[model samples]
Target: MTIHTTSSCTAFEGVRRIASGALRDVAAAVKRAHDRAGGEPILVFDDATSSPIEFDLRGGVDDVLARLADAAANGAGAAGQDDEPAAARSRGRPKLGVIAREVTLLPRHWEWLNAQPGGASVALRKLVDAARLARADNERVRLAQEAVYRFMTAMGGNLPDYEEATRALYANDRARFEQMIAGWPGDIREHAAKLAAAAFCEVT
Candidate 1:
C-alpha cells in the first residue's frame, strides 16, 4: 500500500491504501511510529470519521487496522527548546543542584548582592537567578496587565496608571494579584507558575 503524509503546526494527517484483505494487517506500521515516537499512536477507521480508532502502539495492529489508522500527532511547535527550562519533576520536591565556589568579588560587587532583597544570606547563584527571573517576570506582568486593560477597554472602560496598578498587584493587592492575567495565553499559565516557583523557590 502507498502511504502519504502532510503536516501542520501540531498535526500529522496521512492516508494509506492496502489490499482489501490486507486492511486487517497493520502490525508493522504501528510498530514503526511507536519506535520513532514515544507516545500513543492513533489510527483512522474511515475518512468520514475524523476521530482515530485506538490501537495499542506498544506492539502492532492487524492489516485491517492499517488503512483505518489515521494518526494525528500534535507536533511541538516553533517554540525552541531553550524557550523553557527542562522539567524538574522528581520525588518530594525539585532541589536546586547548586555547586558553590567562594570568589573574591570586588567590594562593590559584594555590596551589590548584599543589598538585594535576600541580602548577603542568599547564595550568589540565587541572587543572579532571582534578578534574571524578576526581569522576565516583570515583562510578563506588564504584558498580562496590558491584556487586562485591553479587555476592559473592549467593555468601554478606561485603565488608569497601568504601571501603578501592576505594581500594586505585584506587591500589596492579593485579590488583584491573583487576577492579573492580562494578555497571556492559557497554555502559558503552567509555565509561568513554574517559573515563578523556581524563582521564589516556593512550593505550591
Candidate 2:
C-alpha cells in the first residue's frame, strides 16, 4: 500500500510565486511554468523547512507525479517534506510506534530514573514531554527563524540588504527586519515575512 504523504509546497518563477498548495498540484504548476515559451527559473520549496524540491520533469506531467508517488511509497522523499512515520518493530511498544534505543545515564541518574513510578522508560518519556511543553514557544521561534534563513539564502541572497535583514531576523527586531527588506523583491519579502510571522508572535 502506498502511504500518501501530504506536504504544503510553493513554487516561484524567478521572484514571483507561481503556485502554492499540495505537492502534486505544485509539481504540475512547476512543470507547466518550466515548459513555457521562455523557460524561467522555477523553484519549488517545502514550506515547512524552506528546502528546495528537485523534480525530475523529464517526461509528461503524469510521469513527473508518478516518480514523486513512487519515491513517497519507498520513503525516499525530498528533504523538508513531512512524511508519515514508517512502522518499525523493536523492543518496546511497537504498537505505540515506540522504538527502543540505547540511552546512557550516570549511575546516580540511572538510580533516580529507575525508582520512578513506571521505571526509567516511562519516567524519561514524561520528562522529555514536559521539557518539550516548556520549550514549545522558544522551539517554534527557532524553527521559524531557521526556515526563514533557508528561504533567504536561496531566494534573497543577492538582494541589497540581505545580510542586514538576516541579522535583524535572528535578533527579533521586527522593525529593523522590515526596514532591511524594504528594498527587496516584493514577493521574496512577503514570503520571507510570512514564514517568519509565527516566530515573532511570541517575541514580546
Listed in order, each prediction's TM-score against the native is: 0.25, 0.69
Evaluate model 2: give its TM-score: 0.69
* RMSD in angstroms between candidate 2 and the native structure over all alpha carbons: 7.6
Tens digit of per-residue lDDT, candidate 1, span 1-204: 323232211112122221111222333444455466444433423211112233344433553244435332112222223544457534577677867677787999888888887776575768678888878876655554444333323221333343543454345353443354343343232222222332232111
Q: Write the per-residue lDDT of candidate 2 for residues 1-204, one digit (tens) a residue.
A: 233354887899999999999988988888888888887699877888887787888789999899878878677545556555556434555476788899988999999999999999999999999888768878888999999999999999998999999999898888899999988888888999899896665532
Error of 1 at 195 (Å): 20
lDDT values for all models: 0.39, 0.84
lDDT score of model 2? 0.84
On the 0 to 100 scale, the lDDT of residue 38 in model 1 is: 49
* lDDT score, candidate 1, position 125: 66
- Identify the runs in model 2 with alpha carbons over 4 angstroms from their true place: 1-6, 76-132
